[model samples]
Target: MLELLAPAGSMEAVAAAVQNGADAVYLGYGDFNARRNAKNFSREEFAAAVSYCHVRGAKVYLTLNTLLTDRELPQAAEFAAEASSLGADAVLVQDLGVLRMVRQVAPDLPVHASTQMTIHNLDGVKMAADLGMTRAVLSRELSRDQIEYICQRSPIEIEVFAHGALCMCYSGQCFLSSVIGGRSGNRGLCAQPCRLKYGWEGKADSYPLSLKDLSLAGYLRQLRKMGVTCVKLEGRMKRPEYVAVVTGIFSRAIHEDREPTAEEINQLQAAFSRQGFTQGYYLDQQGPHMFGVREETKEPKELFALARSTYQSGEAQRVPVTFYAMLRPGEPAQVGVKDPEGRVSTAEGAVPEPARTRPLTTEAVENQLARTGGTPYRAERMRVLVEDGLSMPLSALNALRREALDGLTRQREALPSRHMGSYHVGARYENRKEPPVLTLSVRSAQQITDQLLELGPALVYVPLEELAAHPEKAKAPAGTAIGAILPRIAWDREFPQMLDNLRKVRDLGVTDVLVGNLGMVAAAKELGFTLRGDFGLEVYNAQAVKEYKKLGFSSLTLSFELKFPQIRDLSKALDVELITYGRLPLMIMENCIIKNRTGSCNCQNTNTLTDRKGARFPVVNAPGCRNELLNSQTLFLADKAADYQRLGLWAQRLMFTVEDPQTCVQVTRRYLDQEKWSPKEYTRGLYYRDVE
Candidate 1:
């Protein structure tokens, strides 16, 4: 059966889901989940929610899907143990550290890869399978055909977002919120700054970044036919009424073989939608129609009342029970109740009396024992063995039936989960005597002049477009490795030409290629080029690093989101590197900022955006690259070279973005030596502080 997974931000939402026919519901128990801002349940509430869903024949999937630091990893592992003990149907997770801990603590618990993992393609999904994930909630940006491709090649089950609000940036890859407003999406508190107004090159893209809420309800059959095992709704942070309506709609569309009516589609939008709806990256369209911002749309008061009516009065889910009753002229009346699982309990009533005005019939025994309408249980079958002229008071029969049903409920609640104790932490990192190698990344040919090359770095990465357009810029002095940095956003219409551009860069003596996204990895492999993994790949954990290594990454750049301690511990597992200096690219945006705001784009690589705080951030425009939003302040980490080596990590990169040729040389020289230097305006970034 095709699974319709709903979101449950609170206990009320859980009831809303099951009452409306969700096969399973995903929610959070603490701040551990990505939707930490939502009204999540407590540990006690989580257990109750799980039990409540299980009793109703539905499953509860807990979301512990945020990236965790080293300090919080043990706590996350303990929670995993608790989830297993509570019999969670599965856990949706993003961090590879959590994946490792779950395998150790609760080996039997199925792990579903959260979309925060940014698994958009086959290789990304294959990596999930390699790490023991049983299912993957794929990236929302994937087209239907891309989803079909991943599903076909997937070793595990595929879960796709069929509906709800869409994120402007790719999941797990957005650091714009963190750098700009100190709210990291990877840590689960997104400020949602993308919803703000911004313009691009002359096009003036209104709400260019904010996408419309996704609605694929009309395409459920086509998706199921494509072998998509689970269709997930996107909002756990939304209201219970929203969950009830969306879940009920998709559930029927998937299970009842019913197509959504046009009226129902309108109800979906009226209930909660952003400028109507878009099918999203599904349907293979990334045109102007996909963009939308919030609009004024008041929901009908009647619709909310009707939706709440479904779960308020009675048990949200019904369970069937069979009953057996006995009565005799002088013996006590008794009733036995058994659930479908064969758990049985019997309750004794007051002693039967001799017939007075009326004789006791079999119908008399059955009538009192069969009334279970208010409870979770429904009487499916009833058998009564009775002697004529036996009688019992109505109160006695009612009490006996209630007692038996209560006992049966207790039996179901007592069912044990597959429990594994806490997982053990593995090996630790040791300090290295020698300092790690240094690499330099420059955006323009102007920054990689003779003075910078004199520093004699281990490797130098120039933008691929720069290398392809001017081969002279890629030429390095003897013993200094030269490579081309792949563009982060490689879109469809131009991807074929992008590959050709990569090949052109390769032919010009740039053998070492810094590939970021999965498509770049695939392209590098196809062209037989040496692939260097960039930080854009989101390699946040040891497992992800190993997976990329297995995919033939010669060198790996760890995710910038990791704290210093996490970077240290992860480096112990693999010889990884971190960027030590430069203006970190905060966003790789599809829409051109200059074109939107200025009413014209000079197509020049230089542009600046002033935020509400009046801080100016640089915008880099280049061939083959998306609009690059650089951080307002540069990242200065040269003072931490010793600290980097102390973690047993081997490399520190000096990135030169928006810096002039002279500043690049000066920065390179300062870092090459043990010279302490910090730019006038620089940030330590996420290195020292915890993301949350």
Candidate 2:
């Protein structure tokens, strides 16, 4: 059976979902959740909500799915312990650090890889299972074929977003909110800058970044047949009425094993929608058709009122219960209630008397025990053992039934046992005594010149495709090494070809690979390439750095979102690098924004998006014809060489995205010589100031 996972922002939303037939609910428990802007639950509220859902036969998944700083890991681990004590069915996590902490503090608690982890391929799912995750919520940008390909071979359970708002950028890979403003989506304070309008080549401003909300209510049966464990609905910030409408409809569709009716679809749209729903990603359709902005429309009061009434009645009979009654001539009459979860409760009533004119019948006993109304339980089966001539008052049987049901409810609400261990954030692994060296990452082989390689940089990373195209570039000076960079986003269907490309590069004597996503990690390792974690891995905390090291990464680039103090305090479990120069990437979009606006591949041209403030953010071509939006200003820290060196970094990476070969050479020389120079337009990134 497929689980209908609904989002709950408040107790009202929890009630709305459970009462409307949600199999489970995921909600933010504290400030550590990605939906911190929602009306997240407090400790008291969370406990109450858990009990409420448990008794009603629904699971509660605590959301601690945010990037945690080293300073916040201990507190977040403590909260995970609290959630375990309260009997959370599972926890959804995005940060590897939080995943490590949860495993340490609450070993018995199950962990689900949140969609924000950007798990899209089979290797990613296998890696998640290897890391102890019981399930992985794949990225919403995957097509049905891609999803099916992964699900066919995944070791752990698979979850796909069935209905929800869509993000233009792949989840966890977005930095627009943080770079444009001080708010970070990874930290749960997204300002939603993607919703704003931007222009292309001085064209009319339009919402190229906003995508239509996804709706797969019609595909529940297909998803279930594909072996999906759960189908999640995305709307933690939505109202209780929206939860009721969406959950009820999707639940009905799943239970009926059919698509939703036209009327139900209308009710879904009336409840909430951005223009209309889209199945673009699932159908492998990507273009202007996927773009839409939320338009203000009149609320359908009647639909909302009816939806509200379904949950507000508080009489939803979801859980099934069985009753066993025993009546003897002299002994007390007893009634026992049992739920499907094997929870049993019993009550004894007054003794039965001898037979009267109206004797107690099996049918009569069953009639009284079956009146489980006004509760979340329904009488599914009944067994009565009455003596031949036993007479019992009807009121006595009713009392016994009520007491047993109440006891059963109490039993169901009781917390399940869990184990918790101690956790502590330790100091740095080792104090680095060596000064940091220079490394270069280029978008194409064209960015790599003989002069740049002559600088004797520690490593020069070119794209795997670029190296495959120009395999001769794999040769470098003895002091300078060459590596291949895996694509930031590759679906399961593309892995075989990606592997072939990797093999080609490896055959050319390129022994190093820069991995940005978890899916690429296993593949790169399998090919005998030395793994170097890229910025796309989002190594924010010391624990993640340690996690990457455990995954066989020889080195990793720390997240640009980190402040200098945070970077300084991170554990140097493995060699860590920082981007000292480049136009920092803002968003790695699945949809090609350049082609969406220009109706052709203008990637070779100097394409840029002009924001409302007239800031030009360059759009560069990525693998699979995707687009990467670069930050408006370059990250220039060549003048802060001493500051970075004191932090004990292994290397300072100069990312060359749009720069030409000559410019790349010039920038490498500046960082190599430690010359104090700054571009006319440059930013220190989030290193100097804190991000919200």
Candidate 3:
């Protein structure tokens, strides 16, 4: 059966989800989740919520899925440990260091990889699976056919997002947030600059780049039969009523035989919608409407009224929550427990019996409530009509209300407030001034080893040629052309350059490396280097993350083609840490950009490219190439430090080369030093499938 997962922004929303029907609820506490602005749970609330969900037979997944940094490491670890202890079914996460910390704290807890990890293809799945990840959230950008291919080939269970808002940025491959507003999407401090309106070459009134929400309600049957284990909804920033309705709709469709009609989906669209819903990248179309157009609609007064009415209709009247009565010998007493549906009954633990009027204080009532594990939802003064016609003081009545309501069992709540937590430190390096994750191509082993020792890059992605030549020898020292890229390049018929590069890197005191070639990962294991898998391997989901784990790579980068739901699902299904910061290498071109024009091109010479910040990078135009104008955007995330820290990512990487290394390092460092640094806006780059 396909699980219908729903998003809840608060405790009330969580209850609504369970009440309506949700197989699992994904939420967060403090700042570990992606919806940093949404109202989330506190630590205590999270604990209570988890217990409530478990008791009700609903699974609770805590999102510790944001990227993290060195300074935020301690807090991230503590959060992960606390979530495990709180009985969290699993901790969704990204980043290697954070994963390591979680493993140390809760060895048995499942750590799902966040979509920010971006596992695109079978190789990426194998890599993540090897790393111990149990599942993968397939990227929404994949076509239905592509997802099926991944499912058939993957080593773990697969989950996908069936509905909700879409981002123009690819899940693991965006730098816009970091570059434009100091908030790294990879680290969970995305400012959503993409949602803003801007004029293109000729259009003035519309946001040509903004995307619509994703809706897959039409394909529920295909998803279930394809062996998908979960279907997620994307919205923690929505209202509780919205959560209830969406959950209700998806729940019926996924678990029951009844499929949703087009009419039901249309009703959903009217609830709270953007321009319109699309299938996202699932259909492989990049039309401007792929992401719905933005719309500003007033809140429906009727909906709010309907919600309040629903709340009242479902409320059980027993005692006022503020009542302050104490248990005494001869005062009037109230009796019975109230069910969630507000039915009154003589139950022991569900609701508490009324206590006698006595000297009562708020503290005493609070203590009693804690002891009884109940949260009072409503308070009212009910005359305890007795045969003797005796009445108590209003204070006494309040005390009684407090006692009864306080003692009621706590209920499930949604993810915690979006405002808490720290941004991953690595994102600080990913502002507008930084360079992309550059591949310094080379052909020798001896030259690049020393450089590898000095700079901890996003990844030292090596081409295939040199890997065959070096065949297990150490590379040369830093400061030479051969020092940075040569060793790992494929060189000989069977030189084993990958093993050679790793061996040399380890021997020269280098600890980290990145590569796409699967053979290189196995070879690196033989040499004992801390390895991270790269995008070239096409990791689109959590399964790929787990696959990489077994191969011995320490980290994994996500595919740049994933949509929002795919990103969230992948984050929730993994058991390893993930990463999602740095310059998104938009498209790995078959031919280098510099080949045609050694100087520059004027792609961003339009108004759509400029904002408060001056123009940053120019768009390069290759009029006849497979991808005609390539405009790569810079990452400038300085505001979302709290979010990344909460998600538990290890490092925010900046793919760099000597041409712009210092700028890359300084950008991150400056962002770390000052939490909010907005660079001049640059033309946004395409994360994947850049054709124009």
Candidate 1 deviant stretches above 4 angstroms: 199-208, 295-300, 316-372, 377-419, 443-454, 462-475, 484-532, 537-555, 562-571, 589-609, 619-627, 637-648, 658-666, 673-682, 688-690
Q: Give Cα distance to truth, residue 301, candidate 1, Å.
A: 3.4
**Cα lDDT of all candidates, in order?**
0.78, 0.90, 0.52
Please tell me which model should have the higher lDDT, number 1 or number 2: 2
Clash totals, every prediction: 6, 0, 126
Tens digits of per-residue lDDT, candidate 2, 396-431, equal 888898899899988998988888899967665874
**Best model number under lDDT:** 2
Give the CA lDDT, 0 to 100, for residue 41 in model 3: 85
lDDT of 1 by residue, 593-667 (tens): 456556566456567665545566678884543477788799987776666666656678988888899888788
Which is the winner by lDDT between candidate 1 and candidate 3?
A: 1
lDDT of 3 by residue, 326-396 (tens): 33335334534344445342212122234365444444444433332233244332222232223334444
| Pairs that clash in candidate 1 | 199-596, 200-592, 200-595, 200-596, 201-595, 201-596
